[model samples]
Target: MGPELPAALRAAVEALLEGASRKDLARRSAQVSNTYRGGGSSATAIVEDADATAYVLSRLPATYAAVAAALDEVRVAAPDFAPASLLDAGAGPGGASWAALEAWPRIAEARLLDASPVFLETARRLAAAGPAALAGAEMRRGDLTQPGEGWRAADLVVTSYALAEIPSERLEAAVRGLWAACAGVLVIVEPGTPAGTARVLAARELAMREGAMVLAPCAHQQACPLAAPDWCHFAQRLPRGRDHRLAKGADAPFEDEKHAYVALARPDVCRAAPAARVLSPPRAGKPGLEFRLCTPGGIERRFVARRDRAAYAAHRRLRWGDRVEDA
Candidate 1:
C-alpha cells in the first residue's frame, strides 16, 4: 500500500464529493486531462469549483504521494534541518504544503500561492479539515511567473508539478524568484517526461549558479552526465480511493505517479551529499545483481556477483530512488 491520506483530509474530500455528480466530474476530469496533455495551462483549465474538485479527486492522491516521496528524500538528505516557515509556490490544491507539513512538523507557518482563485479557495477548504498549521495557512492568489511583493521569505520553498505551466521564457526568472524567497531549501517537482526533465535540469543549473548545494537525486554539483534519451525521474505508487476511481473513470485500485525533482539547499544549511543515487531498479539474476547508479563520478553500471556475499546483500536492499554511499 502507498502512503495513506490523513483521516480528516479523506473526510474533507468525501464531503466535497457528496453533492457532485459523478458523470459531470468524470467529464470535467477528462477535459482537464486533455487540456494538460495538449500543453494548456491548468490555471485556465481549472476555473470552476466543480473543475477544481474534479482535479483534486483525480490528481491529488498521486500528487500528494509524489511530493511526500520527494520530501522523504529531502528529510534523509537533511536530517537535522527543520523549517518553521514554508512557501508553496504555484500550490494548486496545496498538496505540496500538505506533504511539506508531514515531512517537517516544525513548519508552523505556511503560505500557499497560486494564480487561480478557485484553486486557492478549494485549497483553503481542504486545509481547513487538515492539520492546524495547514488549516490556518495563508492563501494568496498571484501569478508565480511574475515577481510579487506580498510573499515573504521562508525557510523552505517548494513547487510541485507547477513549473511546466509557465512559459519557457519566464521559467528562469520564476525559478530565481522562488530561490530568492527561500532562506534554506528549495524543492521543485515535475512530471516524469523528457520535457519535465529538461525543466528540472534548467532549475538545477540555476540553483547551482546561485550558490545552492544539491541535496537530493544528484550526488555531485558537476554537470548532469546523463545524455539525451536518458533522463532522471522516479515513481511513487499511491492507493486509489473509491472517489478517485470514479473521478478518473478507472477501475484500478492504485496509481503510480512518476516525477522528476531536485532539492537544493542554501550553503548555510548543513546537508550531506550522497555518494550515489540509484537510477534504476536493481536487476537480480542467477549470477548476481546489476545496479545502475548516478554517482559523483558520473553514471556507472556496477555488477555484484553472488560470490561477493556482503556487497550483494547490501545491493539487494537498494531501490530505484535510494541513495547509497559506496555501492
Candidate 2:
C-alpha cells in the first residue's frame, strides 16, 4: 500500500475542478498523457490553467504517492534528518512539496520551482489551503535545461519526474545544480520505465562522483547489479477518487505508480544503506518464501524454508519494494 493524498490537499484539488467541464478536462488529460508517453515534458503539455487543473485531477495523487514512498526511504536512511527547508524542483502543482511536508512536518520553509506558469499558479492555489509552510511557500518558474542562478541551499532537495525533460547534454549540469543546492539529502524520482531507471542511475553516478553517499536502494556504491532488460523500480499503489476517475476516464479504484528513485546525502552524512533490497514480489510456497534481492555482492535469489521457523516467521510478511538487512 502507498500513502494517500492528505485530506486538506484533496479537498483543495476537488475545489479546483469545480465549474470546469469534465469533457474538456478529460480531453486535456489525454493530450498530457500522450505527450508524456511520447517523451515530451509537462512544460509543453500543460500550457493552460485548465490543463494544469486536469493534471491535478488525474496525476497529483500518484505523483504524491511516489514521492512520499521515495522520501520514506530517505527517512529510513537518515532518521535524524529533520530538514527545516525544502526545495521542490520541477514541482507540478506542488505535489512533491505536499509529500515532503507530510514526511517532515517540522519543515518551516518550502520553495517550489517549475517551468510552467499554469502549474506554478495552480500549485499556489492548491497550497493556499495546505499546511502553513506550503501555503506561504515561494513559487518560482524556471526551466531545468537553463543554467540556474545558484539556488539557495536547502536541507532537502527533490526533483521528481523532471529530469527526463532535460536534454541529454544538459542533464549532468542540471544534476550538478540540484546537488549544489542540497544541504542534507537529495532525492530523485522518475517513472518506473527502463528509461527512467537509466536517468536515475546516471544521476546516482554523477552524485557519487561528486562525493555524495548512497543512502537507499543500494547498499554498496558499486555498479548496479541488475543488467539490461531488467531494471530497478518500485510500485506505490494509490487510491483514485471519483474526480480522479472521471478526469482520467477510468473505472479502476486505484492505480499503481511505478517509480525509480535514488536518495543520496552529503559525504559527511552517515551511511544507513540496507543489506539488500527486495527486487520483486516474494514467492510463497509450502516449503518457504523465495526472494529476489539486490545485495552488496550482486543480484541473488534466496529461499527461506519453512523448516527454518525463526527466519520464516521473521519474513512471512515481507513485501515487494521492502528493504531488508537480511535476505
Candidate 3:
C-alpha cells in the first residue's frame, strides 16, 4: 500500500471510468452460504438482499469506500486497459457488474447472465436506474455451468464472488466460457482464502494460456510462467462503521470477503496515455459523483463525490440522470 502510483495507471483509470455504470451494486452472497444448505443465499433472497445492500451502498461515503477497494484490485491488475463491452458470469444481482460499470465509462453495454429470475429482475432494476444515461444493461437468465444459445464475446468479462458456487468439475468450463467471451479482457474475483486463492490462480493460468495477463498480486517471481501451482488472493478491510451498519441493519465491524483474483485480458482499447486531464469531484448536493481514469499498474481509481461539493455544481457533477436546460 506504500507504492507510488504510475502515470499509465492514471490514464488507464479515465478510459475505464468513461464506461462505468450509473449506480454502485453491492452484493453480500456470504449470507446465503452462512444460512443455507449450500452456504449460499436462495435466488429469491439473494435478489431481495441485493436490493437492500444496493440501497445501503448508495450512500456516498460507504459506497465510495467499497467501490475504491474493489477498483484498486482491478486497476492494479489490468492497468492501461479500457474495456468497451462487458459480460458478467453468474452475475447474481449484478453487484460486481454494476461495480465494473461504475468504474468504466459509456461501456457500450453489459450482459448479466444468471439462472435466477429474481436476480435477473433485480439486475434489470439496478441497471435501469444506473448512472450511464443509457437504457441500462442487457439481462440473460442462464447458468454459468451451462451457458447455452445466447452468448458472445465481450470487451470485459467478470465473475465476482460467484464461481465458488459451482462444483469443481464445472468451474473450469465457467472460467473458460468467460475467457472465450472476452475480446478485450477477462476479470474473475473470488473469496480471499487458500481454497479461493487456488481457484483464482488456476483460472489465471487458464486465461493466460489463452492470451490474458496477470495484472496484480504478483508479490512473487518463480519463473516466466508459474510451475506446479500458486495462489493469487488479496483482501481489503471493509470497516462497516455506523452509517452502513445502520442502513443494512447489521452490526458487522468489517467484512473479510476472503481472497480473490481480478485479471485483465485482450485489452479492447489502448489509450495508455490518452490525455493528461484531471477530473473534478462532484458538489456535495449533487445526486452522486464518480471519478475514474486509466493508470500504469493496470488498475483504476474511483470515488463518490464528497457531500460538500455537490451543492451548486450542476453541470460538472457526475451521476446517472440529470436534466439539462437548453439555452
Candidate 4:
C-alpha cells in the first residue's frame, strides 16, 4: 500500500469535524490555498482556530503521505538508523513528526517548532490521540529563518514544506541551523514544483558543504546531474478520507502529492547508500525496459532488454523513486 496517515491520526483529524461548519471549513480552506498560491506563508494564512482546522482537514493527509514517502527513502539508505529523538521544524499540525514516529518506532521523544500559534495549537490537538511519543512532544514557537541556540538537537530533524517561507538571504542560515541541531540525519521536503526543487537543491548544497552526506535521491554528493529544464521529484498518491474530500470539495478519492526531498546524515552516521535511485518511472515495452537512474557515475539511461531475463524481471518491478541495486 502507498503511504498514508496513521489510523490514529486519520481518526483524530476526522473527529475535528464534529462541531465545525462545513461551509466555513471550505471557505477557509480556499483562502489558505489562495494565500499559498500567491506566495504567502502559513503565518499569514492561519490566523485563527477555524483557519487552522481548515488547513488540517485539507492538508494534513497529503503532508503526512509526502513525509512518510521521504522517510521510506531514509529507511532504505540507512536501515540501521533507529532514531530516539526527532525535531520537527516548521511543523504544521505535527504531520512530519507523526510520519517520523510511524517510520521509526524507536523514536521516544519529539519536539515540534513552528512560528504560528494557531498551527501549533492545532498540532497539539491532533497529536493528543497520536503515538505516545508525539502526544507528549514539546511544541515550541520559533521562526525557522532565525534558528538559534535555543533549538534542541535530535537524531532526526525534518523541515517539510517550510523552507519556502524563508527569504532568500536567510535560507542558507536557516538550513545551517537545522544542520547544527541534527545529531544524526536531516530530511528536507518541498513541493515538487520547479521552484520547490530549487529550494531543495539549495538546501542540499548547503548541507553537503557542511560535511553532511547525501543519503538518498543521490548516490553521489556531486552536483545534481539533471539540468534546469528537468528537475528531480517524486509523487505519493494518498487516499483521501471523507472529511478530506468534503473540505476541498473534490470528487477524487485519492490525491497525488508531488514532492522533492533531500535526506542527509552526519558523515559518521551514514550507512549503506543506494547504488542508484530511479529518477522517473521506467518505460516498459515488448523489447525491454528503459530506466532513468541517478547513480554514482551520474544520471544514466540504462536499457534492460527482455533477453536479459533476470535483470529485466528484477527491473520490471521497480517504479519511480525506487532504489536499484544496479544501474
Candidate 5:
C-alpha cells in the first residue's frame, strides 16, 4: 500500500461523512462510476451538492493516493524541484491540490479550477480543514476544455483524472493550453485502462512537441513500447475508510487505484533519466527473477539468475514502477 491520507485531510473526510447518508452516497457513487466508465463527462455527472460530496467520499482517497505516488516519482526524477505555486486544473473536491501540497511544502500559492460550482464549493469546504495553504486556496469555476486568458502560470500544474472527461476532439487543445500554463512541470493522470493510457500517451506527445521533457514512466521520448494488447499503468493501494467502503459498496479493506500518468518538465530542468522503469512486478522463480523493463534501449525482458548472487540480491528489492540504473 502507498502512504495513508494526511491526518488533516482524513479528519476532514471523516467529518464530512459524519452527517452524510451512506445509502445515498453509495448509490450516487455507483452512478458516477458508471458514467465515467461509459465515457460520460463529469460536467453533468455531478449535478448536486450531494453528488459532489459522494464523489469526494468515494473517489478522493484513491485519486489522492495515485497522484501522490506519481509525484513521488517526479521527486525522484528531479529532487531539487521545490515548486512554489500550483495550478490544479479540474481540481475535483481539491484532491489533486491537497496531494500537491503534501508533495511540495514550498508551494505557497494554489489555484484550483473546475466547471462545477458544487464541486468547487465542496472543495472549498474540504480545504477549510486542510493545511493553511489550502485553507486560503484560490478556487475558480472554469471550463478547462476551453483556454482562457489571464490565468497565471504556476511552478507545478496537475490535472488528475480530469483529461479523460474532455471531449476527444478538444483534448489536444486542452493539453496544449495546460502546457502553456505550466512554468515548471505538468503532470497528467488518468485511469489505468487502455483509454486512460491512450490519453496519457497523446498528452506526452503534445508535451514533447511543446518542448517539455518526459520525467517519469518513460526513459526516452520515443514512441511507447507497449502495443495495443498492452497498456502502461501503475497501481497504488490505499486503505479504505469505513465511509469509503460503504460508499463504494466494497468489502475490501483497501482499494488499489490503477492509474496511468505522465510527468513533463521544462526543457531547462536538468535531471538524469532512469535507464529503465520496471513495468510490472518482478517474477521470482526457481531459476531467479525476471523483470519487464521499459528502457531507453526499448522494452526488454531481463532475467537475473540466482547464480548471479549480487545482481539477484539487488533485483529482489525491485517492484513495479521502480527506476533501475542497470538491467
Candidate 6:
C-alpha cells in the first residue's frame, strides 16, 4: 500500500459493485446479450474487454502485480532508469497503462495511442474514476503503421499485447522507433502463445539490436505453441453481475482470452564475454561438479557436467547470449 494511493480508489470499486449485482453481471454476460452487441465495439473484443476487467477487478488485487513485477525486474537490471511521462502503444482501454502506473509512480504524465475511439472513451472513464494521475493522459487514434506526430514524445514506452496485431514488416521498425523515442524505459507485454512467443522473440532481438536489455521472463527464444492450428490463448474468468450487465449482457461468469508479452526498455546495454577458467575437483563425499563458465555480465551461469561433458558444451557463456530459459 503506497501512501499515494487514494482511499477513494477502493471506495469507488465497492460502490460500483453495490449498484450492479455480481450475479446480474455474470448472468447478463453469460447470455451474450449485451445492449452494445450491435454497437461499434468488436463482438469478439467486447466480451474480452468485459471479462478482462471483471477478472482483474474481481480477484487480482492490484491486478497490475505482474506488470509491476516486470517493471521491477527492469529496475534491478538497470538501476539508473526513471521516467516522468509515458507513451503507451495499443493502450487497450488503458488496463496495462494503469498497471504500469501502479508499478511506477514516478511517471506523472501519460499518452495513450490506439486505433479505437471506444477504447479511448473507456480509457477516459477509467482515468476519471480514481487514478488522478491519469487525468494527464491524452489519446491518439493511429498506430505504428500510420502513427502521427502525437506518438513520438515520451520518457517511457509501453507496448502491451498490441504488437502482434501489427504487420510483420513493421514490427522491427516500430520497435526501433519506440526505443528511439524512449528517454528512460520501454515495457512490452504479449501473451504466452507460440505466435505471441515468436513476436516476443522478434521484439527481444530488435530491442537488443537497438541497445536495450531483457529484464524479465529471461528466456528470449522459446518454442511457439500457437505455430500450429491449436488454440493458444489464456482465459480470465469473471464472476456474475460484478460487471456491467448493460455492457456484458447475461454472461454471468465469462472468460477473457488473451496472449501476453511483457518486456522492459533500457539504454542499449550488453553483457561482456564469458571468462574462461578451469574447475577443481570436489573434496571428500561431494558430488563431482565441473565446467562452470562465468561471464563479465555478472551472473553465476553454471553447467552440470556429464562424464566431464557439459550440457551446454565447452563454450564461452555470455550473460544472456547463451540461451538458458525464457525471458
lDDT of 2 by residue, 1-327 (tens): 678899999889879988999899989999999999998888679989999998898888999999999899888888888899999999989999999999999999999999888899999999999999999999988876664652688999999989989888998988988998999899999999999999999999999899898888786788898888999999999898887888788899999999999998997766664568889889999989999988888888989999999999988888888888865
| Candidate 1 lDDT trough over 10 residues, lowest sum | 143-152
Question: Candidate 3, after superposition: displacement of residue 59 in Å?
Answer: 14
Look at candidate 1 and tell me the lDDT of residue 73. Answer: 86
lDDT of each: 0.88, 0.89, 0.52, 0.90, 0.89, 0.52
RMSD of each: 1.3, 1.3, 14.4, 1.3, 1.2, 9.8
Please provide, for model 5 over 3-43, each residue's C-alpha lDDT reduced to its tens digit, 9 standing for 90 to 100.
78789988887777778779989999999888878878777
Return model 4's CA RMSD, one decimal: 1.3
Q: Higher-TM-score candidate among 4 and 6?
A: 4
Instruction: Please give each candidate's TM-score.
Output: 0.97, 0.97, 0.60, 0.96, 0.97, 0.59
Per residue, candidate 1 scores C-alpha lDDT tens digits across 1-327 of: 468776777888888888888889989999999999899997668989999998988998888888888888888889888999999999998988988988897799999999989999999999998777899999998888786963579999999989999998999989889999999999999999999999999999998898989998898888899998989998888898887888888898998888999999998888865769889778989999988899888899999999999988888888888888874
Put down candidate 6 lDDT per residue, 104-146, tens digits, no spaces. 6778888888776655665665667645567668877766656
Displacement of the residue 300 alpha carbon in candidate 3, Å:
26
Report the C-alpha lDDT of model 3 over 104-194, residue by residue, as the tens digit.
8667777888877766775565555554521367788887877565358877777766677777888788777877777776667666555
Per-residue alpha-carbon lDDT of model 4 for 1-327, expressed as tens digits? 467778898788778667999889989999999999899998799999899999988988888899999998899889889999999999988999999998998899999999999989989999999888988989999999777644679999999999988898999889999999999999999999999999999999999899999898898889898997999999888898777888899999999899999999998885884679899889999999999999999989999999999988888898888888865
Model 3 alpha-carbon drift over 4 Å, by segment: 1-33, 36-70, 76-79, 133-135, 219-232, 239-256, 267-327
Q: How does model 2 score by TM-score? A: 0.97
lDDT (Cα) of model 3: 0.52
User: By TM-score, how accurate is candidate 3?
Assistant: 0.60
